[model samples]
Target: MARYVVIGGGIVGLATAHRILLDRPDAEVTVLEKEPRLAAHQTGRNSGVIHAGVYYRPGSLKARLCAAGSRSMVEFCAENDIPVRVCGKLIVATEEDELPRLRALHERAVANGLPVRLVSPAEASEHEPALRCVEALHVASTGIVDFTQVSRALAGRAEQAGARIRLWARVTGIVTRGGEQVVRTTAGEVVADVLVNCAGLHADRVARLAGVTPSASIVPFRGEYYELRPERRDLVRGLIYPVPDPRFPFLGVHLTRMIDGGVHAGPNAVLALAREGYSWGRVDPRAVVELVGHPGLWRLARRHLRYGLTEVRRSLSRRRFARSLARLVPELTERDLLPAPAGVRAQAVTADGALVDDFLVVAGPRQVHVLNAPSPAATSSLEIARHVVSRLPTDRSPG
Candidate 1:
């Protein structure tokens, strides 16, 4: 049996391990996670939106996997008896300038083969009664579920499938000995015929440790959010998003009625001080220094200085954040908003300053690394697992 070692215990890692066992039941599979529990970081902290393939470039991995993953995820949830709802979403264009982008996004959505339509303000209001928009793209496939629950279910099923998941096993070093990978971790040493890196925020560093030169460095961006006051939650029926700024990867501030019956809003993206930085107070000097030294970060800043500054300002001011949200729902105000937990996105920035807009997976000798998987990664986790596992050598012979 081939021994497989997977790094990180987020949904992707667990899903990958599960996929491997499904293909090779007799294979030895082990998952290493630095955290005491699974999904401690990005997997647990996201907005929990199962994205449709609306915003990504039509031919990109995101478009393909997300479009497929949406259906697969819902099916998995149903089979596992997990609570999931296809709540749908509205990408609203509140201003005249946003109309063109909205139209373009509609075209892209159609090209990507999604069941999306351009709706008039009246049509949008029928979906979200309080919404005020000139035009909107109604994506029916969009859904909501607590991903932490999904990760737990994945871990349980993988464990049941004979996969061993070791928590608190932080990888320290990696070396190849006798044609097999020897991974040194906090808990102990592990030997494997294949190594899979799904470390999410620290994926690039892990790739380097495994002797893979990643095309990009992970730059953390904190997405700050706020929840609607209980009474005000009625303003949002499902999900209401603004037409994204095409220049950046972030989808602008809007409102989402989570599966739990509360409403969330305003996840403005800003530079995070640490790889796991969720709030401004959680700063790490080393991470800041690394960001300062990265040429791509500087280039990215230069290109989006105004946009970055605006995000920072919004992060600092509740009133400004509320105003941004008000663009979609005119009835919303500062009093209707309450602070919510934030999530940090590990975005890949190239040395040339280009943001990797697609899911990036790199292959090395007996190793596979997911270097960039932000946003729809949770939505695309299952397909990503299938895609990655399919690339491994099919030979069942021992190393």
Candidate 2:
């Protein structure tokens, strides 16, 4: 049986290990996570909305995987007795200028083979009574669930399948000798015939350690959120989103009713000082120096300077965030907003400063590194695992 070592214990990492065992039951699998607990980073910090393949371009990997994974996720939750809800989502267009963009999004959704329809203002209000929109795209298949719970369930299933997971085992070094991989970690040394890199925020660095240069560098972006007070939660019936700007990858501030019954709003994206920087007070000098040295960072900043400034303003001011969310639900006010934890997205940017919009997986001898997987990654975790497992090397060549 081949010995396999997988890095990171987030949902994708756990799912990958589980998929590997399903495909090769006799293989020995070990997962190493730096954090004391699983899903400590992006997996645990997201808004937990299972995307319905609405915004992706036609014929893309994200489109295909997200569409399939949504079904699989709901099925998985049902099988494991986890709570999940297909609450549906509305992408609202509040102004006349946004109507065309909303219509284009609807066309894209249809082209991607999703069940979506364009609804008028009255129809939109019927779905979300407090919402104020000129038009909306209703995606009935969109759903909500706690991804951290999903990650825990995945770890349990993988462990039951004879996979060993070691918490607080941080990988520090990797070496290749005679077709085997020698991995050095905080916990101890591990030897494997194959290695899989699912390190979310530090994926590119992990790829470099394994002697495989990634296609892009990982730049962290902080997405801050606020939860609606219990009294204001009723303002949001389900999920309310804005017509995203075509220039950026982020979906602008909106409202979501989480599976746990609380309503969350505003995840405006801004530059993060560190890979795991969730708040402005938390800063890493090394991360800042590295970001300053990267040419892509400068280029990206120059391109989105105005938008970046606006996001910074929103981040510093609760009133600004409230005003942005008010575009979707007119009843939302600053008083109803309460502080919520933030998540940092691991986005990949190329040398030319173009943000990677699709799933990026780079391959090496007996190794595969998932370079970029931001939003929808949690929604598409199982499918991503299958994709990664299929790409594992079959040869006995040295890693």
Candidate 3:
């Protein structure tokens, strides 16, 4: 029997398994992935920007890990000979009214121990000539890298460390038999001394299936993006972002320069009709009913009705979306933006209407469930993995 069974072969699970093997090379680890390959969902589809420790409250898990992981991930990439660039990110405040919020953001970054600088409008323009802003906070530590490449490398490391990755293996049930866990997967039954669930989109469902209930439900929010028309890709030199609205839990749409040297922009967070729905046509009635049934969803909508309405408006109206970008870069016209791929976030919300702000982990006698891992999880994979593995019961021998 394996020592550990890691469910969901995304970055977190693979990183956890790899880290376990790193500590105890003799431990047998098996990673069960529902998809054909790793990171095919959120991890693979993300914007590929290594987030700076900006936007999160100081001293939170998100703050601690994002900053530490930002450095660690960069080192891992360089050490592994993966292609990466330390092209910093710019959070531009386009309006006179937005400057105060930008300053608050800068103060948070400072509190979070990130090396950030306040750049004047003229100075901000020096780096991004076409961008217009009252001011911008330049995070020298923020950078861009391909998370998929990093994930593949981590998977390779895990394999080299003696961890077995089983693909297209959806875990249907997890039940403890006597002192061990019976992980019923598509491949076959595997009994192990320990289990870890790192399912991103279906994390809550996975936990429920595993007989652990958390307070929150996962709601899928679709983030839509548009690439700058090829003719005007020069509008963004690196990453450009607007000050996000505080009313909503989401960090509003922003422009990013991908590691592949392409500029992509806008990930407007809107309610998706289906859990995995990428386009407008793919709607699941059950998912819709379940999404609507969550009291948190209703409470969140009621509390942020105006903000919710605005996001829906932007989703339906390209002119409105373009206007949002125009606020930061006046040079970009509606015709200059073209449709791009969308990424749906697995946003967890409390029944009381609070968006789970930081990482949530629950530990059992024989298992651990990663309930909610917010943004930068991909960036903080190794550190988060270290944390997760350390929580496992060390006294138990392999089953």
Candidate 4:
């Protein structure tokens, strides 16, 4: 039996562990999570939208994995009795200037083999009654699901397969001795033949600890959201997104109809003070200092100073956020939206100031580190697990 230790108990880690147990029935698999419970960070905090291979560059890992994962996720949700809605999504162009981008996205989606179509204003209105769009790309495979529920299901399946999950076992150090790894944790020490790092926000740190040099640094970007008041929920029938600006990494402020029967809006991306900073008051001095000292961040900020300043202004003003949403649904107003929880994304930024666009995986002897996995990661978790497992050595001896 091969001993496998996976750090981080988010959906990706749990999914990887589940895949290991499925492949090697006699494998000794253990998951260590710093948090008391699973999915404490990114997996639990994201806006539960299952992407449909749109926007990503065709043939990229994100495009391929997301396309395959979308189908697989729907099947998994059905098998596990998890609630999921394939309500579709509209990438709308409110003005003539955005129409070219909208068409380009539609072409990209089609090239990626997704079921996408360019919808006229009347056609878009039929799907979302209040939406005002000159043109829109209707992505039929786009859906929503509760990822926390999915994580729990994955954990349950892994546990049933004889995998052990230790909560609050924060990994403090890693030492490779001979052919095995000694993972020192807050609770105790664990020895394993192989280690997989799926730590989302702190992935780069984990890689460094494991003696691997990641090409990019993890920069936390906080996405703030607001929920539609109960009565105002009727305005959004499904997901309504703007034609994203090709220059920025973010998918501008949009509205989503969540799986739990609530509609959420905004989510303007801004730099967070801490890795897990969800609010302005939760700033960490060390994180702030590190960010300020990073030359890459300075370069990125210098390039996108105006856009970053706009995001900051929007984050501070409800009216600015409401106006962005109004571009999608003219009926929406500031009063109709209430403050909702926020999510922080661990975006990978290269030393040259460019955001790492694709999924980045760094490997060392007997270990693999998932350095960059944002947005569609939850949707792509299963495929990512399979891909990671396939990369492992095939000649390892059974214990």
Candidate 5:
């Protein structure tokens, strides 16, 4: 039997291990997590919107996986009794200048085989009564669910399949000995015939530890949110998104109705001071120094200085953020927005200063490292896991 060691206990790692055990029942699968519990980082902190493959370029891994994964996710949720809502989404073009890009996005969605429709202002208002738009693309496959719950289910199913999960076990080093990979962690050392790194935030570092040079560096972008007051939740029927500015990497802030009936808004993207930094005050000197020293970050900043400044302004001023949201939902006010938890995105920046726009995976002998998986990652976890597992060399003898 093969021995598989997976680093990171996020949903992707759990799903990968689960798939491996299902495919090779006698294989020994072990998962190592740095946190005290699974989904403690990106998996738990995200906005929980199931992407409908609307924004990604056609034929990209993100586009393909998100489209297939969204369907699989709903099926999985239904089968496992996980709460899910296919509430749909409206990507509005508030200004005439944004209409061209919105049309382009609609074309991309069509090319990707999503059932999206371009709606007029009236149709858009019918879907979201409070929304104000010149034009919009209605994506029916978009929805919301509690990803933390999904992660828990995956963990439970993986454990049931005989996979061992070690929590609070931070991987310290990896050594190759006698044709087997030995992973040294805080809890103990684990030896495996194959190692898969699904380390989201520290994926690049983990790749380096495994003696592979990744093509990009992980730059954490903090997305801060505001929740609508309970009385104002009715303003958003499902999800309301702004047509993203093509110049920026992040999807602009929008309103989303959660599975639990709460509406969240305004996740303004800003450069985070730490990998797990949820707030501006939570800074890590090392992370700051590393980010500052990165030539790619500097180049990225130079190219998008004005937009970056705008994001920083929105991050600091509640009124600014509310104004941006108000462009989509005219009735919303600054007072209606309350502070919500923030999520840090593990964005990968290439050496030449371009943000990696698709899912990136790198492989070495007996090892696979998921280098970049940001937004839609949670939605695409299972499919991404299948892709990762398929990439592993199958010709190796069982250790």
Candidate 6:
């Protein structure tokens, strides 16, 4: 009988458990992970970029969490001997028409209290000789690291602090008996006074299992990447992003230098037909049908029809994808890159086809569940965990 049961071993869940122990060393917490190891989903399968709190709406959860979390994340990494580098990032205006959007981003960053600077083309070139941008903003706080290592360290620290973690415990249902929750898993069951649903890909489903009302559904979007051809790997010194279209939900495909040395390119967002579908070949009829039948998806289809169609075209044709890259780095050609592993996003959407723009959390009498935590989640894991712990009901039994 643990005091708290955290479903999902991703960074958020682990961080929540870690914080609970940090706050109350005597507190008993159990972390249930479906996979045999942690960080197997979005946590492990990301571009590894440490966001700099830019691009988030001012006064929003993203802005506050990312700014604080970025600093806490780095400090946590340093304290735990985890490897992370503030390699910085460049948000470039490759198209003349994109300058306005870039300027707007710079303004937004300022409003968000981010320490960003406008870089001249030459100055930008000094940082990235291969980068071709009319102008760019240098975000010094952005960095890169292996989130898997971070997650592992957090898990270790949590367990060290007297928390328990169960691997291969795929939570399938949550039964509420009296005032406690019995988390049903493949292994068996774990009862808890509070249940934190931090399940990433399966968050919505898990919440429903916990007898919570799901306001939105998780729509999987696969972000496909490409590695710079070995010879041209030097083209990107760090993260290089295109000016995002405010009308779009995602930052346009850009190049990001991985902690492992290679630069990954173009995580073009595409609707994944399956929950964990990573390839075009992978499909789940139910998932596909559910998505297609959704009014929000149809509305999204209408709103970004052109961009969606172009993404679909690029997704199927490497040549078109390479051309999209050429807008920023003119020297890049189709031959300069190779396919890389893809990551899927568990995007929560409303019935009206609008993307959830902020962090969404729902509360219970005895539990608090993180419903939707998007991009900055990895960057904001520690802070998110602290917040979750702060909200927990303290009077309970130790498992």
Per-residue lDDT over 366-395 for candidate 3, one digit per residue giving the tens place of the 0 to 100 score: 888888885789888888998898888774
Candidate 5 lDDT tens digits, 232-342: 999998999999887666899989899999999968889999999999899999899989889999999999999999999999999999999999988899999999999
Tens digits of per-residue lDDT, candidate 4, 222-277, equal 99999999999999999999999988778999999999999999689999999999
lDDT score for residue 325 of model 2: 93
Q: Work out how many backbone clashes candidate 2 has.
A: 0
Error of 3 at 269 (Å): 0.4
The candidate with the higher lDDT, 2 or 5, is 2
Candidate 2 global lDDT: 0.93
Q: Cα lDDT for residue 263, model 1?
A: 89
How well does each candidate superpose onto the true structure, as a TM-score?
0.98, 0.99, 0.97, 0.98, 0.98, 0.97
Per-residue CA lDDT of candidate 2, range 113-165, in tens? Answer: 99999999899889899999888999999999999999999999889999999
Model 1 per-residue lDDT at 27: 88
The deviation in Å at residue 314 for candidate 6 is 1.0
Model 4: residues with Cα > 4 Å off, grouped in runs? 395-399
Off by over 4 Å in 1: 396-399
Note the residue pairs that clash in candidate 3.
none
TM-score of 1: 0.98
Candidate 6 lDDT by residue in tens digits, 139-229: 9999899999999999998888888899999987788888788988998989888888899888988888878877888889999988998
Could you tell me how far off, in angstroms, the CA of residue 68 lies in candidate 2 after the best superposition?
Answer: 0.8
Candidate 1 local lDDT, 132-230, one digit each (tens):
999899999999999999999999989999999999999999997766889999999999999999999999989889888899999999999999999
Off by over 4 Å in 5: 395-399
The clash count for each model shown is: 0, 0, 0, 1, 0, 2
